[model samples]
Target: MNVKAQYRVGGSGLRENWFIGAGFGAQFFYGDHNRQMYFWDRVVPAYELHAGKWFTSGLGLRLALNGLQNHGVTQNGSHGTGEIYDASKWLEKQEFGYMNVHGDVMFDLMNMIEGYDYQRWHVIPYVGLGMMFTWEVPRSNEISANLGIFNTCYINESFDFTIDVRGSMVNDRFDGEQGGRSDEGMLTLAFGLIYKINYTDWNRPRWEAPPRRGPRRADAAKRLTSELRLSEYDALKKYKDDREVVRQEVAVLVPLPSATVQL
Candidate 1:
């Protein structure tokens, strides 16, 4: 974990920069005979809800729940039974309801270079491993290796706009048949919103930063100075009154009046 903060050059905590997000988009599958089908034919609606925390401005961790449905093109009879999509006997669409839960280690590219900035877009690239459950027949469970990029921008203190592009690679048999390529995978693009629970920014770039504790108390207990303070006293009489006289004034009256009467 210490190595993960190489670019952070700042201090942070697990509780500091946490976020949750949800979005909807489309997914495409590639494997087996899926390669023979039109790209659009393999398209299915995708959705995701994820939450994560930034341990540092440059590094983070996330857990995402991605789901609803998956699309594929396979020989109609090649898919499993019980709740699986059953098209005509010819090669056709194989759709199923699925949910993939994944945990990722995220690295912020922009953070590595310029550190955290709320006003600009952050480019985060991540890698993870997950379990994909296809709710069909005898419930097939497969582990997938995931890779993705997230583009996000601050919309407000509490909200952010984000776009994500991701891919998951799994065992060839994940799609029910083991032929074709060595492995199967799917690609996804989702648009979403992320929200911060309390404080909404990273506590990095400047390592001295600390997480928000909470609003300060309105009326804290007043400080008691009885044992904490000391007072100094001086008697006023000791500093004597000093006096100095520059000049003394006296008034003279009748001398000019006798001369004026004679004139």
Candidate 2:
């Protein structure tokens, strides 16, 4: 019996290999007017959902939606009396939210060099440009750019855990305050799960028929002729042996003329 091994073939079609992922993380904004760092109020809830396809082992494309809740504190100076500044009297708190819809180009570093391995970890870096739509007192939209790195660890054949770190650049009015050349972008760190929707074995073995060397009909005819010749030779030998045995038996029974007996 001949056994053949199958390998995975990297799928090139649109529907063969695809994945969808969702993640949640803390998002922080850095802007000119609000320079505070590590403020509890500054960190907001952020989430992301994306669908992507890998055209090759090294290259892929993704469309994603990122949502963020943003918070900012207003600076109000003390009265002219200058007696004392009240924390609760003048400090104003502002909160808003925004959504980003973007398309990204993904590059798989591991797959580009070493090749795709479903069992191994992959580090993918991506860059994207899109628009941010803010929902605040004065709703506004602006163009934005994003840079991110995604790390995927395969938990099974169809699922993976991912760690994503991203940086985004948007218009200065994103925080409802315009003070500098550009508004502060956001930094997001998230953890999520990826599910493979369509799994194609890019490594499946492709079987090819070996070349035929001779005509099929001629080979079959030659084989049959050789078998017939062999059978005929065996039959002739058997017949000659049987005839000699019969002759010997007859001579013994009939008692043929001997030298001492008259003719």
My TM-score estimates for the predictions, one after another, are 0.69, 0.66
Candidate 2, residue 124: Cα displacement in angstroms equals 0.2
Report the lDDT of model 2 for residue 224: 62
Model 2 Cα shift for residue 194 (angstroms): 0.8
What is the overall TM-score of model 2 with all chains considered together? 0.66
Off by over 4 Å in 2: 1-11, 75-91, 204-263
Prediction 1 TM-score vs. true: 0.69
- Taking the tens digit of each residue's C-alpha lDDT, what string does model 1 give over 1-263? 01123223564564577889999999988878877667787788889999988776677899999988777656644452323333443465567777889999998877565545667899999999999878786367999899999999888888989999999988888777778578887899999999976554554454322222333121111222321232211222223322112111111432344444554
Q: Pick by TM-score: which candidate is best?
A: 1
